[model samples]
Target: MSKDVWVIIEHQDGAPKKISLELLGRARELAETLGGTVVAFVPGAGVSNVAESLGSRGADIVYAADHALLQPYTADAYAQAVSQALQAEQPTLVLVGSTAQGRDYAPRVAARLGAGIVTDCASLEVADGHLVATRPMYTRKTIGTVVFSSGGIRIAVVLPAVYSVPPAEAGRRAEIRAFQVALDSKGVRTQVREVRAIQRETVPLTEADVIVSGGRGLKGPENFALLDALAKALGAAVGSSRPPVDSGWVSHDYEIGQTGKTVSPQVYLACGISGAPQHLAGMSGAKYIVAINKDSNAPIFQLADLGIVGDLFEIVPKLTEAIRQAKGRA
Candidate 1:
């Protein structure tokens, strides 16, 4: 197999996602250690524009796979096309972002190639001539070190925000090549005719720098307004533990736990959460955790960098006002 690190680029609104650029940055480091070049693969309809600028970000070579069937991002088409390309080139390592879209199709590509894959990797490095990944397992109770066996391609689905995006090097250029996947009409199983996006007041959980999350201590759906006020003051996305979601206090989009979205925000302010293992598994990667609960012994306090033992109903509003006033002064 060639010692080339390949990154599958994911884009939105005609630009590459932040996670994709992050993957490129990590790939550059890995390629150096492996004595290989960084290769970026952009698969979409009319994606030459998207593939062109990746060179400065770190890719030494770019393969633009443009086909009509690749549009609208059906899992079937992506899996088939990517698997076919990887099969042909046989790169040493394939890296994909562990977003919803990547989670949907990456496993299929791995299955097609019969390659070993590690998902939701926290860190990756070359150890003893093989790629090693650190992954959280069993609801994040333990972290396991994984090493790929010899003689096959390796794939890793990395979590977002784990690495810093490198500054683009001016005047650095890559060999841009057009790659075509022989797609059969019958092979494309799903068709997306329309897409309706939801209007969100805050950024998506995965992309948010700060998150204000609530749990069972919220008491009722109306109480989330308190969280909303706090979130607005802090310029943070609003999230919930499983209880609030199950109680119909909020939609699943606002949920953050093992069964919900995994986030690694710069700050995670968990209010009223008891810090269940499942809930901890999702947001434990946050840079700083602050918890507020009436119980001093609440499990969340153990993981919190700052713990407030008080009633959230009284504390949250005061905190929100303080933040708003602080912002006004700034």
Candidate 2:
């Protein structure tokens, strides 16, 4: 098909990023429904080797733009290359992962193409032949939906963990084509001197499907280990309420609330949490919620799909062991 959907591929240390693969998986379904082709577009140096990997995730073709200076991820280089691709290919929709690099570059590409753009989108659909995107608004307390009615190319940046990963097909092969876009001699003004990776959890918070979070009710900073152990047993990420973060019991990065990162995991196990409005704003969108608290009257129970009234100290370990045994049997 001539009309195509483009998924931007992001890679680091010669490995594809998780969020990009998620987009490709969802893009594949959309492409099939719309009777269009799925294209994976990669712009960086020495990226030709990743074409097959992209194809396995549902890309029919790989449009690779490799250049020496493009490896460092300058906004100017990526924007120019993607804009050039849109002009040459005229894709029906552009999908990008809402990551650090994407947050910077997607807007530039949108401005360059004069396309209607949406950021931090959590879901996508095609209705009435128009690309529509849904995103969290008002600090994630409300959902906002947008449709591209400009009759121009559509661009959207999807958030992490919004879609499940697609199974890989090792034998799949995609058509590879080298896309060329000459960079202006003075266009890229900034230089990336170095990139130092931060120490991250096994599963990043936003990318986690299941999360075990603690709050002020835990009583002590050291008690976080209880949730940590439970999280490890379930292969989940550990998160926190603002009180623990403010008390220095956990890092601010683990905090989930109005002032913290937004999460929409498949299952959110809130341990010793009171379900304050600020905290609810972040995780209320979870697909299923299980609240464990000593107080049966805790407000969190209102939003929880399942509620367990008891001391988390005694309950968490038992639950962890059950899950461990279940996994072992499986």
Candidate 3:
């Protein structure tokens, strides 16, 4: 395999996703170490501008794969296109974000190329000319290190928020190349007809820097307003434990636990969550955790950086007001 590192870019709203930029940043570092070029592979319909935008963001070469069928993101089309490119180029290492789309297509690409892949990697480094990756195992109770056998392409699916995004350098441009993939449009089975969105003011839970989450103690669906206020004041996202989701108090999109979305935010505020093991499996990677619960002995308190023993009904409004006042004065 060539020493080049290829980053399969994921985009939304015609711009690269945050996780894709993070992968590019890490790929830049790896490429520098390997004395190789950082190559960004962007596949979508009318994504030429997106490829150009990545030029200043540490990519030495940008491959623009524009096609009509690539839009709306069908895993079948993506896996087929990327696997073919990988088989032709055979880059030394490939980096993909562990986002929903990445998790789905990356494995298919690896399978098609007969390459070794490690998913949900929290840490990555090159040692002795080999890529070493670390991932949380067994609900994050332990960390597992994976080493690949020599003589083939290696792929790693990275978790979000684990690495910092590098600042873009203005006026820097990379060599842009046009990539083409052959596909039978009629054979594409999966087609996205429409997208229905959940109307919420808060940022998406996985991408939020701060998260304010609740649990069974929220009592009812109406109580989520408390979390909404706090999340709004802190410019955070609102999330929930499985208990609240199971009770139909909130959508499953808001659930943060083993059976739900895994998040590693800068700060996570747990309101009335008891910190079940399954729940902790998803958010144990947060930089700081604050738990508010009436039960002093709640399991969440043990993992919390700061624990408040009090009724959330009384504490939430006050906390929201305090944050608003602080922001107002600033």
lDDT for each candidate structure: 0.92, 0.87, 0.91
Q: How do the residues 209-233 of candidate 2 rate in per-residue lDDT, one tens digit apiece?
A: 8999999989989999898889999
Model 2 stretches with alpha carbons more than 4 Å out: 184-186, 257-259, 328-330
Candidate 1 C-alpha lDDT tens digits along 1-330: 899999999997788888889999999999998889999999999897789889998999999999999898999999988998899999999999999899999999999999999999999999888789999999889999998876678999999888878998999998999988988869888888898886779988888899999999989999999989999998899999998888888988888878999999999999999999999989999999999999998999999999999999999999999999999999
RMSD to true structure for each model, in Å: 1.7, 2.6, 1.3
TM-score for candidate 1: 0.94
Residue 240 of model 2, lDDT score? 93
Report backbone clashes per prediction.
0, 0, 0
Candidates in descending TM-score order: 3, 1, 2
What TM-score, over all chains together, does every model reach? Answer: 0.94, 0.88, 0.97
**What is the lDDT for 118 in model 2?**
94
Colliding pairs, model 2: none
